[model samples]
Target: MSISVVILAAGQGTRMKSTTPKVLHEISGKSMLFHAIDAAKKISDDITVVLYHQAARIQESIEAHYSGIHFHMQDAVQFPGTGGAMKGVHVTHSKALILNGDMPLVTMNALESLMQGDADINMSVIKLDNPSGYGRVVISEGSVVEIVEEKDCKPEQKEIQTVNAGVYCVKKELLESYIPALSNDNAQKEYYLTDIIKMAVDEGKPVHPVIVEEEEFKGVNSKLDLAHAEEILQRRIKTEWMKAGVSMRLPETIYIDSRATFEGECMLENGVSIQGASHIIASHIKTHSVIEDAYIQNSDVGPMGRIRPNTKLINTHIGNFVEVKKSTLTGVKAGHLAYIGDATVEEGSNIGAGVITCNYDGKNKYQTNIGKNVFVGSDTQLVAPVTIEDDVIIAAGSTINKNVAQGELAISRAPMKTIKGFFYKFFGEK
Candidate 1:
């Protein structure tokens, strides 16, 4: 059955207290809205995002990342509420799965479960120990009769532990028919989508309840909520990787981006952060190191190393305090304290400690190429646009600015000078 997805993102999350829209807030390195959209896309291609607050900004941001998304600007001033957000939205399918944009942790499996129930409306509900702030789902005779808002719930209704999850899979016909007739006569003067439940029940339409875990439907309305969601998502990501043969020490301290992938037995130490589209294959990332948008295979990166974007390391060892950016190191070993940026160090090369590739000259950036069997000594600086041919040796403390031919030695250092008895004269026979 084809199902259309409608993500409601019209509310200005005032509790979040930020210039950015509430849905734009990030959890697990992606905006909460994107996470909802991502889960929605898995269930349906016909997706519509309803926006009101910062509608243009939200549309522009989403368009940069996704295509074929239909955005609807809600009339927030006149018809304001969840029901009003769907004023003129069109659904391509007979069934529409409505999701809240702030609920970033909702998974595809949970959404799919709603489709299993054969009813006019399938509403998600969770049994919380304390359903204080959420609307209570009133079930009568094995059917969901209505949802009573927390503010309007009677004393007995307040004890109902089953709360609405704010997610629904409804027939498109019902939405088009009843959404227009919704009234905002309550205390808040906002049209309530929950009212549709009582309306459906009055007409003897089947209103089924799909019970889900509380964690899956967590809504992020504040920074603390965002942090809790991020923690949950991070644990999920890390636990999945661990089950897939990737090991981590002090897993709580390590952070992995959702876009990062691991293959074939990788290990991450304490304080290791892997972000972006990094692919780690059979490698070990040591303590406090950060790997971002890089590829590593059969290598070990520092106790404090940083592998920046566009870098690839194969069978290499990057030691403590080493930072490699936009470079490829093949079968190379740089022990410690090296800055290799915009450079390529080929196989059988050894980059000594304190070595740096001066690949930038304030105005422009350049590359440093070191050929096979090259040895860059400690504290040596390879200036921009420099090349060291095969079997070339760079002496310690030398600053090489020109290219060196095959098997040649390059060094540029001032001669050492000493003044005899200078220390004794300055100390006055001390």
Candidate 2:
């Protein structure tokens, strides 16, 4: 059966105490709402996101990343609450999987389980030792009879250990029929989506409770909860990479972005961070190095090096304190203290320590190209719009602005003078 997805993201999230919308907060480098949408995409593409607080901003952000998403605006004045978020929304499938946007850890497997039973309403529930803050799910004869919110629960109902997991899969027709008639008679003075359970039970419709793991349903409401969720997602990402033949010295200290992927036995040392869609193929990243949005293959990057965006390294060795940005190095070795930006160093090239590519000249950026078998000595500066041809040699401490032809030597140092007593004369020494 085809199922549509409805993600409720209209809440103010006042507990989060930020100008940013709650659903926009990130977990493992992705917003919580996007995570919910991602899981929903795994099941169906007919997805609708309901928004109220900062609706325009949220819509704009989401539209930049996704297409064909149906956005619904909730009427906060006339209709308010989870049930109100679905007001006037249409579903294209037989069933609609309603999800809370704050639950970033919700997975596709857990959602697939909700589609198992043949019931009018499939509600997710988890048994907790202390279910204080959540609504209680009252079950009778293996079916959910009612859902009592925490504020209105009686003393006996308060002790119910089975709590609503805030996720539901309901028949499209039932949602269309019941949501319009929901009453706001509760203590919260809002139309509760949980009221649909009692409505279904009153008519003797089957409402099955699907028990799910607590970790997958964790909701992020405050800064503390966001941190906790980040840790959980980080651990999950690292564990999956390690299982896929990637090795890490201290897994806890290494941070990997969710969008990053590795292939064919890569290794990372302690304090290494890889971010922003980096792809590593059989490379070894040493301690304290950071790589961002770069492709590295069969290379060794420093004990303290940084590879910035748009860089590609193949069989290269970038040593300590080296930073490469927007450049490609092939079979090259830059062992220490160099910055190579907006440049390309071809095969069999050696970039000595303290070398820099003066690519930016305070107005516009330019490129520096070094051909095969080129040797750039220590403290050499290759100015922008310069090229060193094949088999060219650059002397130490030279600043070259002009291109060097093939098999030529380029040097720009001033000629030494024989000022024997210059130091003593300058210092006024005897």
Candidate 3:
């Protein structure tokens, strides 16, 4: 049988209080919408995401990440309500799984349980400690009878701790039939997807309750809920890393993005944090180098090289015995005591300490070019738009503003002033 997943992502999420669409908010590193999509892709061959309210932005983002998934617009403006929103979709499938876009923590295993087609209809339900604002599941004789929303439930129904988790799997033909019969007679005048449960019971259709572990059904609705979901995502990532032979100095203290990839035996020191689309491909390290929450794409580092905190790199290659601090290195070998930024260090050069290539010139910025095998003196400053010829030497404390000839020394300094008995003269005021 063909299995398809339909993800509902049309809600505007006024409660989130942000311009970004609710499903687009990130948990750990992956967007909430993408997390749900990835889980669904593992169990189903075909997946459709329904979008609205910033639909263009959501579609573009998802297309960039997963280009093959089908996209559908709920078009709340035209369709008017939830029931009518899905009216025209036609799929060539026997079964489909319905999911919400904001539940990022739902795993593939949890979804597979609901897809076991032994029952005519399966719905995920979880028992909540305080199911105050949720729809409570009503069961009699171990069979699900109905689901009552908090507002529509009677006093006794409100006390039922078992709540519907808004996930369902059913025969595609059954869904097509009942979806058209749904009514908007409820208080909000909005078509409630929950109504299908009652419709199934009335027709003597067996509804199976697939109880989900509390963690698998957590949904993100507000900023607080987003944070809670992110914590779970981080723990999952850390556990996977540990299983793959990567060592985390303090796993609980470190926060790694979900998209980060690390090779085996990589050691993240205490207080090390990796963020963005970064990866370390087969690199070893020693303690004391703090790699901050920066992006490293396709790079390797040698042991004892210090990656100063907050250094951002992309498509770059790094070597050993290098120390980078507060700079952005974009290409190969841009390391090794390299004071790069607002500067660029070419391949294969030893950047001496106290050697600064001055880039700022009062009103505008400038560049400095140093040739191969050039010895820059300690405390030397090469002013911008200047070049040091190959095999040239710059004297100590020189402030060079002009180019130097190849294989020659350039020095700029005021003549030293000397006075005999200067110390005695200063005391006598002579």
Candidate 4:
């Protein structure tokens, strides 16, 4: 009762107009092939990826991330067609589920339904408003008889709306027997996998067709198709997050990565983008904030905050126009106009307005360590290779180049002097 999955990822995706392979093109921050592969993994781990056209590069890109994947290269010598690709695969199970890598929106429920059907062959089919170039499903006596490609169909057959979705669950033995029988006599002169549908009917194998929503089979073949698919995916993501008690003031204005996780009641204001596998918990992110690869908990950040990778915040408040990169802030409040980079601020520190940690020194970046209850005053510049220990107070407008010890007051500024009536003297108004 085992099943093998064959992912058809060999197409060059010529319509995408990029040097990168079409399956490599992303939707919602994940590659199209990965979306298909992830779903297939949920069903079965024995996946054979049929590769062609930049096959090595595709293999290299995904091999490290996805283990136990069998790659079969479809090259010129193989006469690399879909049917030709299947003929060479070494499937271990009696049943094989074939899927196209381009279709990302195919649900696991539909696939499982196909698996659970009591038939020798089951393929997912969708009824489109305009079938156009898709192969139409010919039906008779309350069941699917065969699939007719648009090029091979008559004028009446061309009017059928139910089209082949390129998703199939077939018996491996039956598939192997007829794969060589597929002919290449069409105008395109390619051995199509669709011909097997007719072959199965002729062989008296029960063909079960599972109808799905048209959007579930939306394939990404071009840049326009990619965008359309992205909209569908984003809408799905937003709806799921919303259902999980995360609030977005304007959902359409956000572009959140699919891998990002959120916990507790969080409020995301307009124009807030959270990307790259970040985690959030009970936080309020204000408008126009960009956070990538960071972790936040019970923190409030910006109407315009830019938090970069590897930053961790806890019980912190980072205000407007502040940018923090590669820093860990715990119980810190840096309200408005600051940049804290490559620094670690311990609990109960107040980083005042217009403060910056000068972490870079031309050759390499250095770290600034600030201990508990340290008060960094306004307009202060903390030069790198420095530390302000516990209960230290950095005076306003000072540029500290050296470290300050515990409970000490550090200031590096020239003495203030008065120049009376300087404006009158310069203007010659006497």
| lDDT, candidates in the order shown | 0.93, 0.94, 0.74, 0.88
- Candidate 3, 80-134: lDDT as tens digits: 4656556565555788788899889999999999987566689998988999888
lDDT of 3 at 325: 49
- For model 2, residues 1-430, the per-residue Cα lDDT tens digits are 3999999999999999999999999877789999899989999979999999999999999999899899999997888889889888899999999999999999999999998777999999999999999889999899998887799899999989999898999999999899999998867788878888889999999999999999999999999999999899999999999999999998999999888999998999999999989999999999999999999999999999999999999999999999999999999999999999999999999999999999988999999999999999999999989999999999999999999999998888899879788989898987
True-structure lDDT of candidate 4: 0.88
Order of all candidates by lDDT, from best down to worst? 2, 1, 4, 3
Listed in order, each prediction's TM-score against the native is: 0.98, 0.95, 0.77, 0.95
What is the C-alpha lDDT profile of model 1 across 1-430, one tens digit per residue?
4999999999999999999999999876788999999999898989999999999999999999999999999998998999889888899999999989999999999999988767999999999998888889999877898887788899999999999888999999999998999999987898888889989999999999989998999999999999999999999999999999999999999999988999998999999999988999999999999999999999999999999999999999999999999999999999999999999899999999899999999999999999999999999999989888899999999999999999998887899999999999998896
Model 1 pairs whose backbones collide: none
Model 4, residue 149: C-alpha shift (Å): 2.7
Better of 3 and 4 by lDDT: 4
Error of 4 at 153 (Å): 3.5
Superposing every Cα of model 3 onto the true structure, what RMSD results?
A: 5.3
User: Candidate 2, clashing residue pairs?
Assistant: none
Alpha-carbon runs more than 4 Å astray in model 3: 77-84, 150-159, 282-338, 341-349, 354-430
Worst 10 residues of 4 by lDDT: 75-84
List per-candidate RMSD values in Å: 1.2, 1.8, 5.3, 1.8
Residue runs of model 2 more than 4 Å from their true location after superposition: 151-155, 417-430
